[model samples]
Target: MSDRDEQAYAGTAEGKGPVRIDEELARHLENKREELFEEFEIRDEFPPEVLREAEERAADPEGDIRTELEDRRDLRELTTWTTDPADAQDFDDAVSIERTDTGYRLWVHIADVTHYVAPETAMWEEAMERGNTVYLPAYTVHMLPPILAETVCSLVPNEDRLAHTVEMHIDGETLSHESIDIYKSVVHSDARQTYNDCEDRLEDPDAPLHEANSLAYELAEKLHEQRKDDGSLVLNPKRDRAHTIIEECMLKANKAVTHTLQWDRGLEAMFRVHPQPTPQEWDEALQEIQELDGVSIPGDAWDDPRKAVNATLEEAPGRQLDKIQWAVMKVMPRAKYMADPFGGHHALNFEIYGHFTSPIRRLSDLVNHWIVYTDGVPDGIGDLCDHASDKQKDGETCERIYKDFLQEVGLDPHAVNNRGIEVVDDPADAEYTA
Candidate 1:
């Protein structure tokens, strides 16, 4: 017999294994091979630009874009004029302050992403491929090339960068603001600060930070508390399972964007909104809550929708709120791309809320900023949204396929067990045995 045939039969002849490979085993092996090939592709496909940028950053971390902007003395350095960028490399959004006849004027400057990531540039294509930056447990997969995302397109300080600015007139007492205008403009970030540091400085006068930073911190606090009092939801949703520390930066950035959109732009943009609970779903959620006794609903549930949701969630600690929210989300129509002149945000009970930040990370926000700022729309804003949605779906599928591949390779045991065929319903008893 041929050597290959001989080897194939050796195990069977020794009574150590099956005589032939089974279909299931063959399929599993094929999946494992495919997974290894994909891993190879990922490694090989690592963008050369990103690698170069990483090397440059490694060689001179301080020379990186974030650092340069933070050190600049232009508008970015003036706390009274503009707040620091959220992250050092963040070039997308900036907060501006002005003394108005009424009290104060605040403007949020957002990067005009459509200006650079036109229809199908290499950076735009890469961003589309990623759907969004994926913050895995150990690493991050950015949606755009680092050169653009971390530098040029970023809303860095000191440099006169282009932006879609949203100006607002604030009533200092209630921390409420009326949108004044949304238009393209130029900005220079004076500083770069993280939420923790900013919050600390705001709470403690002795904390070392720019003097103007204290004012920004105070304003942010007033706005935060005002939103809570104004019926804004404040459910601290559970994070993804494979948590990453970098996500905190992203969350803070998201909050910054939300604040800018709601307080400055005044235009209603698509939001990740959650409707009030329906009777049926609320009942089920309540049942689940009752099952776990000793949990109390928050006292202020009736006063705020967010508080109410928090109260329901307080009944069960940990992921109970997240799971319930997910269930609630499933019952509602998903928030999608749309144009609304009135600032109608049902969940927040606001007339205006949009996403104008994170152009470096999200395609939708990038596109939205362009539409609101520039006089004319980009080549294909509608098509871009459609394509972005498709790409997002495709990425999700690829993730699922990769997880299955890992299972086949014995790298993810939980995945394998989870995929086992589930019996939906039992057939009529016909000599059935447990």
Candidate 2:
């Protein structure tokens, strides 16, 4: 190798330096590693039978699609599109909008993953076992194999992919069940855009896909206002116009699907439930908030904690915002998948909610799809829900552990600022200095 190449590789190569890991950090890392494998299988390879079925379906994905022409709308000609992260591989959902005489007709198209992976199949069982995709910094463990998630079942641009659509006729930006219909659909996405571009073009009058993008922005604004009015918490730090648009669109679709499965069909399915915190937990959360922000909340704040939390966040100092939000979120109970339908989502302020958007990565969504199509759930659904909920927690734990390791090694995963702490020579006397 050349001298320059050797110099470039010296400090960067794997074995060039002796990495120092202190005893405390080392023990924590080891414990986290054990917890990871104990809770998650980390399975990546699919069985031969499952791969064979996926390949067969990929070849003729829509040959045997069972959408009734009279019932299901033929929306392939509509100007539909998807917006996601720049690095996203699986395109699971799309949106289309048009102005009607009464109001706006909005179409949310979700990829019909269950149409490919049927019930009681090997592929279906594997998906249930995986529960959902576990995405780490290095790699992703997809719930469905990549063959389907990245290629066939993904709602790619200009491709006619089968979908289960929620068609809503909005008058003045409100969604009513009377004007919404759920049915199978065939969609051809006009284009695929990224979240960054959507944000950039939020007000571009002549931007590509201007009509749909503009309408989506208006609808999302209304929905966001409604959510705030209904006492929903806005804890996400990265809330923006583009993010709000996509979030509201997905929320509308998920709410519609859940309403159909629970209220219309009365089918037994897994619901995404978020229970309210007990009085003790609420007291603890309030205590943490007071400790962080030094702002005392009223005793009656528990009645409408969303408003209290958001109001406190506005007054929270800039430097303490991140840590304060983290502490507050740590006190909140985790949302889980449940078989019961009546359990409401406390966070979203929904009376009923279910995972119905990304069947490509979530088994809970696939179960919802199965219920939609077959009008019944497969055997062992209760066990599947339990496993999925556990795996979801495991996935979060694994990501946290991995991110911690990355942060210690001077790599901030979010990349907002440099988090490189200085290392003391004694190893035992490690401390940070400006």
lDDT of each: 0.47, 0.72
Mind sharing the TM-score for model 2? 0.82
Give me the runs in candidate 2 sitting further than 4 Å from their true place. 1-39, 62-72, 173-175, 291-302, 415-434
Model 1 Cα lDDT, one tens digit per residue, 1-434:
01010111111111122112234544554564456436533221447765564344335433443444553223333342222212233445666565666666666666656655655455555665555543211123457666556666666655656565556666667545454555555466655544444545556667655444544544555554465566654444332111111222223334444555545555344443323556665556545544454555565564444556655654566745656566445544433444432434545555544455567666667766654544345564456555555554544454556556545444432322222222222333211112
List candidate 1 segments past 4 Å from native: 1-77, 80-91, 96-101, 120-130, 156-160, 203-206, 210-213, 237-277, 298-306, 311-334, 339-346, 378-383, 390-434
Error of 1 at 57 (Å): 20
Whose lDDT is greatest here?
2
Over the stretch 252-355, how does candidate 2's per-residue lDDT look in tens digits?
88888888888788887888888887767766776787776456555545568776666666666677667656756776678888888576887677898887
Location of the lowest summed lDDT over 10 successive residues in candidate 2: 1-10
lDDT of 2 at 94: 92
Query: Candidate 1 has what TM-score?
Result: 0.58
